[model samples]
Target: MSDRAPQPVERQLPTEEARDLLALVRELAQREIAPTAAGEEDAGHFPREVFALLSRSGLLGLVYDEEYGGGDQPYEVYLQVLEELASARLTVGLGVSVHTLACHALAAFGTKEQRAEYLPAMLGGGLLGAYCLSEPSSGSDAASLRTRAVRDGDDWVITGTKAWITHGGIADFYTVLARTGGEGARGITAFLVPGDAPGLSAAAPEHKMGMKGSPTAQVHFDGVRVPDTRRLGEEGQGFAVALSALDSGRLGIAACATGVAQAALDEALSYTAGRQQFGRPIADFQGLRFMIADMATQIEAGRALYLAAARLRDAGKPFSKEAAMAKLFCTDSAMRVTTDAVQLLGGYGYTADFPVERFMREAKVLQIVEGTNQIQRMVVARHLAGPESR
Candidate 1:
């Protein structure tokens, strides 16, 4: 096989403004987040302070419209910003992505009144938002969710349990998908359920393997009443809306995966260059050099995939298949890079003294969440098979 691999055609060279934003993100991430990530992860803590800092810096609303105190930037730029934040701390990166995904219902399909009421609090206040789609039994098969929303006069009474919800307890609002009609995906409907709605309560957070700093909980909505005005999109259109939102959300996850891989590769490069093996640095070994080469190559390819999908989104083109492909490639790459990084450090890599073990742990969750790699393959295959398969 040729040593030169196929060049990914999806590279997104950031603009000057994007570079400036990256500089700001890097500064904040290294100075503020890096110091606390380990401690918070060990204690199973959430960094509310980071949200405040991001809000004040206008980083939270980088992709939203300017009218709502947002930057209205392109997805390629926004995703790079997300990557930089995630490289420092996955919790903040995921929190930001979930918030952005939550805004999709309002931004793309909401009524003017709904957007006016909610978009500001989301983009301007850095008030976190959680997407309530996955149920206890319905994970990758999200359309089959059992959550129910019954119409009651001027309000809708929601009763269901949303599982694996990031920011479930801490979010200011939730973009909930519930069954309002009959069965299957078509029966689902979306709503903007305020976090403080009566009868809405969150269960104790789950004990996760990684991203521990970002709380995941089961939110129970027992007869939670929401104004009819809070309904997102038309009834029965919720599944489509949720799918569309997830297509973009998958891109965010892809960026996160790439960041994790990049971080792992960086750590491995630094370690191998300094740690001596047989009177020379480990990097001097040809075998380790080849491994590093593979890691760098995979990370670059993953970046290209995500950026291509992001550009498609920015251009308002069909990008669902591309998003799935990116998510699959990037997350898989992250898992491999982090694993190899740990192996490179030998025993030290397995210990807490180095962050490679943490990166390895963190990379795994990226592959499991946001429609798992298997689901992503199904999505891509369906897309490739044309409308007949779907």
Candidate 2:
């Protein structure tokens, strides 16, 4: 890895305020985040303190309401901020996104009382969160989840296992989905489950290909009780809430994909410029130069696509289709760009000695998470040609 951090993308932020925010985020990414990313990742250490610092800096809640301790920035500003953080480290960037996704059920659909009670701490109290929707058998078919939440007066007892959860064991709280009515999508309900709730236990984190610093575990809820006051939306409305949150979550993943690609491109450029091959620099070769150019172009275009979707969301317009497209295009671009980056570096790229290889590993997960690229295409296809024939 280079001793220096990657340069920030020259962002066209909407306001002077937004510009200042980006500058601060970039500075933090370079100083506090990037400097230790490789070592921490290698050690499989989760930098929870860095997330605390971000919460204190007000970066954790950039897209939520200021009344609830958030930055109240638009999605455009938030996504750009995410891109910068991701450029430094994907774990932190995607961690922030998953936190936002966990908070979304209450922020967007919770009763006003629920919002007033939980939003502040979740936004800036250094309290991390996890979202639980994917289960052992319900990855793509989220509606078919089998977790059960049975009503018992004012309390509901939840029992089932949720898999592939980020922040699974470490989160302060969880936004959980369970079946409260019957089978399928219409049967689900959303609840805010405290992390330390009785009977809530998380399996050891999975040994993953990348983002090892970010925990992915399976949480078991064995008769975990949740109060009625903690229910996020109404009974049988959890599926809608989960889908709504995912549309925005997909945009976050898109921004993260661009960030990783941007980082890979920067590393490739840095290496080629300094590495001598034919008595000069490898960058001097026309073929290599063309590869670099193509990588840069894809990164730029992916950024644009995600930002466009974000703007549509901010404008209160229907943006699900655009969000899915952005997610598909940007993640695929990240996979391609990162692979090209490795090719550009020759043998050095294949080793853990450089960040490009790490970027390549990290990019693979983005295509699979936040609705896999295959899933993103299905979503876009649904928008285009309606649902697939049963």
Worst 10 residues of 2 by lDDT: 1-10
- Candidate 2, residues 1-390: lDDT per residue as tens digits? 334445657887899999998898898899999999999999999999999999999988988999999888999999999999999999999999999999999999988888989999999999999999999999999999999999999999999999999999999999999999988899999999999999999999999999989999999999999899999888999999999999999999999999999999989988888888769888899999999999999999999999999999999999999999999999999999999999999998999999888999999999999898989998899999998887
Number of backbone clashes in candidate 2: 0
Alpha-carbon shift of residue 122 in model 2 (angstroms): 0.4
Cα distance off (Å), candidate 1, residue 172: 0.8
Across 167-256, the per-residue lDDT of candidate 1 in tens digits comes to 998888999999999989889999998888899999999988788889999999999999889999999999999988999899999998
Counting only residues 3 or more apart in sequence or on different chains, how many pairs clash (N, Cα, C under 3 Å) in candidate 1?
0
Best by lDDT: 2
lDDT of each: 0.88, 0.94
Give each model a TM-score.
0.95, 0.98
Give candidate 1 misplaced runs (Cα > 4 Å): 1-14, 387-390
